[model samples]
Target: MVLAAAGCSENAMYDLDGGAMDAAVVEARSLEIVGDPTVSLAGGDTADLTVQLRDPSGAPLAGETVRFALDGRAHDSTLETVTATTDAMGLAHSALQAGTVVAAFRVRASADDAASVSFDVAVGDAGFGSMQVTPEYVGERETLPRVVVGLFADADCEDDFVRRDPGDRLQVLSEDDELVRFLGLPAGVSFAVAVRAEGEGGTVLAWGCEDRIAVEALETTDVDVTFDDEPLVVDGSYQTTSVFPTTTGEDVATALEGARDALLPASDATLILDAAEATLSGAEATELRAARASGFDATYQTALESLGPAAAHEALIDRLRTELTSLTVVGRLRATEGELDFSVLRLGMGAGELEVALTELTIETSLDATLDSEELRVSELLIDLSASELVRALATREAFDRLLDGPSAWLASAASCAALPPPEEPIGCDAVCLQAACRTVLADYWTAALTVIEALDQERSTLELDGSANVADLAGDLQVDTLEGSLAGEWTGPSATSPEALEGTFSGERITPPR
Candidate 1:
């Protein structure tokens, strides 16, 4: 049987016999304009435009050809029709150049039997101008050796006015000379210029604004920009000391006196005749006898005799040191922040030996403070404590023991003392025993680590931080995956100085370990 064939519409489905089928068909449904829809340009400047085509299902329609047409109240001879083929992503690109006359125009992109999208372009007069930027150094070699300059229509430098039409801003690289010149700017327009070094992010090294620059029809307007390069140097030091709650001076003194009384010999018969005669009178001897008969003495005399008075004093000092924590920080300021290097040391003291548990860290931080309020917000904190020296110091001390052993053992001892019944005396054997044990252990394990110091650099591994301050009060929180910690304390001294001076007492606790 022979069948008649029928032609299909542009987007209609077809059968094998070339007959129009009733099946559903997909067609281009939308045209989207990409890039900047509104552009400002000086006469003779050209800008690229893009259009995107999509099917009824919102999927890109590729391999399609799109034609562009320009429309305006008064058209220039340079405005001409152009065509571009859509790529795999359905994007078609075309270029438009402004004419010598200043006017506003619209460009439309259309596909065969598809919706069209339009973009607006504004053209200014053919007049042109130039700007000359000169660096005025406040001190010797004040300016950076290399910098990039950006000219904007607004004072914020957020909008690039010099190159508003097509290409990047006119960024002149300042080399041997201090003057950088930008040419071909839209004449008679006010502009704000900002100078900054590469890799500085958005920090502005220098900035200025030219209110107005007059450019006659064919003549060039020359504008001069002078920027002062002033170097700001800020350096300071801060110190802090902290005494543990359970190991205060008053507690230690009472413990020592109780220990002495407990160790005294009891009866005249049991006392060493010669030793007692030399150290105590008859009345004192009777009192010592009374103290021994009472239950207050337990191993006190044996400990005193075995360790000796000097060793006992040394042990006490060592114990006290272990309970004390201190921190010292020094920093040099740059821009809005400062680079700080700090060390926290837990001191252990003995008769003839001294030991320390040390941790060294470096951080970049900024201080935000005002005279009106006592609160100071500390921000932009980047910390690093991964130097080999820091590792070695930590390895030699008990500061990191919390990571391995969990909560400190001293805390447990303190809890045990708290559980005991209140004694008639301020201090008793339970507290004294724990303090003595801590002293003995520290003395036995005392060893010094070789100190190694190195300059701080940003390339090293660093952690972020958040903190706050109030006049003499300060607190900081460390943020890191493997380590969690905090620094809190009070400080005193001059608020603002060349090298801002600070004296304070600080305490820190490690919540986690790197391992």
Candidate 2:
């Protein structure tokens, strides 16, 4: 009898050990669930989970694999298992899952150190479900990295709850998979938030940007979630979404102006020209003019190339240069909403200013657009100036009529050839006649200019004359000691033309009154 009892006892003890190993230590992430947890999951829908494994003492246990099963026959499979390993304290977790049925979940985990632990499995008969919301905070000139929010349900809300993300990899989950409440984002961005609600067993309701949270530098806005059944449904659901702004600021005017001044001749070149042109004599004056023109051309290109880092003055110079060539103006911008206005000149194609504007310049895009908005891509940059006005302004009014008369036409003609190539092609070389032609053209231009000048309505705008006819006459009779070598004159538009018009009076080089 003793021998039989011993054998029986040993067998019972072995069975007991096996039973302990198969027992499950199961847990949910948090108590006092915040929202309706029951949800209908479609075939591919994913739900977040927060699970825990522990011993009876509430101490976490380790190395646990939990198997999940659904009761409904329509489930892809009634048996689906997930393996989890506990931390040093024996605490382990399983993320939430989206399943076909709400009331069909059963979970169990191994609870022992010897390949398994003694434990128990716990599951809700109503099943796991949850709803959530998050807010995104953004800034100007800065990227909006991430956003989060929380949800709250009425006292009548059910306790059946699951998290939105299991590992919180998709979103950072603190105590639960769902963070329906929001807090703490820096002042650099603007934000809007929203929530997702798991409706019934087979349905999910989503609320887009239901919450607009503008997190400022020093404060956090309120995050509240409330919902109603617009259709007079049996249950109520709620959710919210988040949006943000990426940039902000005040000094756009200064920024744009700084961008402009960079388009000119170097400050150093301006200084050099000033110093060099100061003491020039008659002969030196001619030399200075040639040198100045060459210097300007070379320095202008260099300055234009260096525009990316120029000051305001340089920008002004660049704008002036725009009047010197051909270009297009694409669009304009206002840095300060009401404080400033500007137009951007788009340089046309090829070796001139257009190519220059294409060079990279480091300007903050948000100076005009939202920080999150696209960069203010500029294919061309230039200063706006009126070439036509410059043309009109440079004409000499008072002296135009005189140069077109008698021998003066001939001398002026020669001077014109000396200054610029004739605009059109012609035959028969006659120096005297050519000189007269220059005088005539110059007269026409000046008169046209005078017409423009009257329109300007400016007081003292002036121009210089290259006076004319015979070389000898220019060198002698017209060369009165009292007369300045340079003939400079100023004029405005003629209300009427001179009563005395000129006719050909002297051979080739002279301007004569027309009879």
Candidate 3:
């Protein structure tokens, strides 16, 4: 279990300058629990808890309302005072009664927007045991941020322990060389232990495994896990020789059209119609009229006009296919996880005045090895889109006007106007107000676009290889043979979305030594 500490929460009030406003105008800046972080008590024992609330300059904030809540089951554990106001010392107090059951729980103290902290409480006799793990290689290297310990059922230590469920694991956020402990584990069971050193970006740098250890009730199990002398690494390059046949231009067009229509909810139709009347006229107004009669194709044309012909959308998909089939992918193995980065692809229209940029695709790989089985599972793919850049370039009012070539100019001669002219302006008319609405419409369009991009990001495909190697080999140049795999859409285990196993072979070869 991770013991959380009280941290400072930002509540900045800025004046006209970027500098912070006066501290008197700010609320509580931090909230800290003053009692012990861990409490061990027999059943029916009571513990008093106190929290302090402070302002920006570390001054006491008196009379502020503080709230207390329980996180997990402490059996029938109850907090006597659920709420309390701070005293002159910025402290608030509450009491917790340890109930008639043996369980572990946490008490959380919070106040308004101030940061919160939690304390672990265990109410039991001698039935529970603790595991204390120390890494053997930490003294020889730099400190890491976190150490993850997993208790697995595999006695021989063959299973992928990193992917195990929550109840059997402990992740302690700390600097290297600190002893990590897991409390409240059931005793008298022989289990394997997996320990990994997590560095920046949560990357596993070193790992060790030990098997067949028994724990005794009411006592602490001390174990030392020996990790790699140094972090393992691999550098290489690979590429896809062929694109997935199922990926099509029609799919791209359908995604774009769906994103466009989602922005025009029924309630906003009247607002869009009024803005359209004030901004679009002459040939453009007539174009929309004839298109809306054709059904859903009308909404597609409305957004597509600024993007050019329907064929342009198809061309972009063709470019995506070409880039995947031809580009060389750079890869690296940072300890256990393998990452493949694809080259950036640029899809453009209107002589490159409007462009959408596609960046790298990262593929995570896992190696499994045992006497009976040796395989590598590569999945968890993410395709990064230039959504923010696209919004700035194409989803703004200025871009709309540039693409349509000043449609508001034709509004002057139009007979029916949905809005009145602004004061002190004759020809300005509702064109300015209509433009403001146009900004809202475009903002909604990009919001929908971002939603589509997020879904696309989660859409993963899987591939597998038929063999694995010792973890030490990852520090040098490593290569894998051609392997067959499957392609699927957003697969979580097996379901309707899982596709048939596709026929293809891709291999990897390392190019550089460990970084």
Question: Candidate 3: misplaced stretches above 4 Å?
Answer: 1-28, 127-131, 135-145, 148-173, 181-221, 225-515
lDDT of 2 at 367: 18
TM for candidate 3 is 0.35
- Give the Cα-based TM-score of candidate 1 against the true structure: 0.34
Q: What is the C-alpha lDDT of each candidate?
A: 0.39, 0.27, 0.46
lDDT of 1 by residue, 270-386 (tens): 222223323444665565545546733453434334332233334433444453222223222222234433333333212111123233333333343221112224443333322
TM-scores of all candidate predictions against the true structure? 0.34, 0.20, 0.35
Candidate 2 lDDT over residue span 1-515, tens digit each: 00111112322211111121111222221111112223233334544323445555556545654433222112231222465555665544444444333222222233333222211111222222332343332322122111223222111122223123211101222222224422222222223333323222312232223323334433444544433211111111111111111010011123323443332224433432343344345765565456556555354325334321122233323333433232222223332222322233232211222221332221111112110011122222222222233322211111132343322232233233333222122222223333343344434333443344333324212211112221112212221111111111122222323111111111112122111
Model 1 deviation from the true structure expressed as Cα RMSD, one decimal place: 18.6
Question: 1-515 in candidate 3: lDDT tens per residue?
Answer: 11331011243232111112233433437777686666666678899988888887899899999998776444587899889999999999999898866555567777775655666666665455777877665433354444566554324466553333211334342442356676655454565777665554445655677878766677899988777533333333322221233332233345666654454444332444445545666775665445445452344334334332122223333433442222122233332234334332332222232212222223343433221112334443332322223223322223343343321321211211223222232222234554454444444444554566444323323332232232223322122222233323222222225432323333333334333
Who is ahead in lDDT, 2 or 3?
3
Following a full C-alpha superposition, what root-mean-square deviation does model 2 have from the true structure?
A: 28.8
Better of 1 and 2 by TM-score: 1
- Residue 301's lDDT within candidate 3 is 34
Minimal lDDT window, size 10, model 1? 474-483
Global local distance difference test of model 2: 0.27
Task: Arrange candidates by lDDT, descending.
Answer: 3, 1, 2
